[model samples]
Target: MRETLLLLSGFVLLSSSTNLDVLLHQSVPYSPQSASTEQAWIASLESTHTETKAQTTSTVEGERVHGSMTREMKRQYEIAAYRRTKAQARSTPTATPSPRVATLNPIFDKQDIEPEHRVIADQAFRIIPGHCQAFLKNFYVRYDNPQHRGLGGKSTIILTGSVPDEEFRALFFHELGHLTDLGCFQGTAVAGSTPYMDKDEQIWKDDPSVSFYQISWMNSQAHNRGTTEEDFVSGYASWDMFEDFAESFVYYVLHREVFARRAAENDALAAKYQWFQEHLPDLPKVAKSNTRWDGAIPWDITKLSYDWKPPTELVARR
Candidate 1:
């Protein structure tokens, strides 16, 4: 049976034979304006925090007494403390301050996910770069065969059913690649219409992804002038520029040495690899000792396994 791939702006039905491993639900075009607004909000929070700290210190000093209080004094102290607590609560924001300027925490709707699976999902989410993490807004766990291996879009990621931890992690990383492409790096907005149609090179010109897209794709459906599969990271990457980006992203992260070695042989592959290095210089890479450059390319790169670092706290960044 064929399944429909849901996009934020519209839906496109895919044949059963189509690789549905990674699907995107397009979200709002990311803009610097949003980041600036978040920066302003953060500054306000810092100011409020400073004021609250001073107020709390003063309150503590005032409340100190050498002797036991009488009934009247006790009642007044209780009221004052109650009022102070209320005031502080009102002033303080619920969201914790992050070191990064405009990063947002991914909200996990874990009601559908098994406890053990949720743990694995959390670990996978932490492995991606902080800039990509900022693009995620919601995460969901679901069970839908032939439809939901993994879906990312609308600032959300949805994982289908349970699988081995490593496989789950790899799948999540691929979905994150989608989020990173759509969210962190956005195309220019076309007037009076959506900007995500893969065929439109004009919208993509401002994006770093354009360089990668130009290497293998003239548009979304055609190859760039003379490029071919030899220039792509995997068979799956040949599907389109978006898939090319996501697949290349996963390869670069999970099998850096392998990707580099492959790049040495092909000029197109080398350009793609260099793009990642120049754009995401600080992205975490799987240790070289843990990866091997088997000349054979997996049709689905996300299914491969490499030594992944233990989960650490996710740091937010712009």
Candidate 2:
């Protein structure tokens, strides 16, 4: 995602070019033009949230609220969000796309996917077509239940279902990496907080069986060229310690042989790989052909953004 920093109404808005910027621009206190827009957006969100609570809650006498109305309202909210996102995209100059027409890969719709390819997607992700768009322009997966937000056990991965099978599967594995951390394989903390920061290559420095020379040398070259932000696996991994572990986990799980070769050539990666091998002992090794996780998915999440409102047909709302 491309992040742009903006100074607006005495507030620093750090937003992804699409959803974040659209939703955030309205909240600037100094803009009268946006205040009304922001209020309407907030109202939509509140209304949906309120309805969700009403439908799910019971009175002291144990009577349920208006369930049908709640369902209807939810649908309205989804349509509203979809419309708002489109409106914002048209108005926001920065969001205009290049001349290239990116083909949207549909993950659902039985008529759309080939019979052979559609075999296990719904079984794996429990995707509900029409409830949500095939692709979320801004994010890969959204874990929405209070307990499941971000990476949590209670969370179900809400996929955009917009990419090709291989790309979608790669995203699935990446989220799986987040789930791994949520399960306790948290790799490292921020650099200043732990010795692991500078010791990625030397986590087992004193262990005679480990060799650090090759990875350390590689790290030095990377530092000189600014190719990697840290001694983690990839540039994206350098964003945060958690992401670092996730990136590494996906690589090791999917492309074991290739990752192993790379690990052997770099001590830091080897130690990280060793950590996963020990930490997630039961993690199955996948065939190289199955390792489709290569780069970040091309996210054009204009459809995923909302001026305000909860999705009406939310697949896993809580």
Q: Return the TM-score for each candidate structure.
A: 0.61, 0.36
Per TM-score, the best of the predicted structures is 1
| CA lDDT, candidate 2, residue 86 | 94
Q: What overall lDDT, based on C-alpha atoms, would model 1 receive against the true structure? A: 0.60
Per-residue accuracy of model 2 over 1-318 as CA lDDT, tens digit each: 112223244222333342222111110011111110011112343344443453454332233334444555656655766787898889988856543333223432234233433332332232222212222222222112121112211122223244445544544555545444432222232322322322123223332111222332333223323333335555555444435554665566545665676667665677877876765565544325322324332121111111212133221221
Candidate 1 residues 95-213, lDDT tens each? 96665444223354244456656665655566666666777865655443433366665275656555676767667777777777767776655432223353322445566666677
Q: For model 1, which pairs clash?
A: none
Cα lDDT computed for each candidate against the true fold: 0.60, 0.37
Task: Tell me how candidate 2 scores on lDDT.
Answer: 0.37
Query: How displaced is residue 37 in candidate 1, in Å?
Result: 32
How close is each model in CA RMSD to the real structure? 11.7, 20.4
Instruction: Give candidate 1 regions above 4 Å deviation.
Output: 1-106, 127-131, 144-148, 190-196, 199-202, 287-291, 310-318
Model 1: how far residue 282 lies from native, Å: 1.2
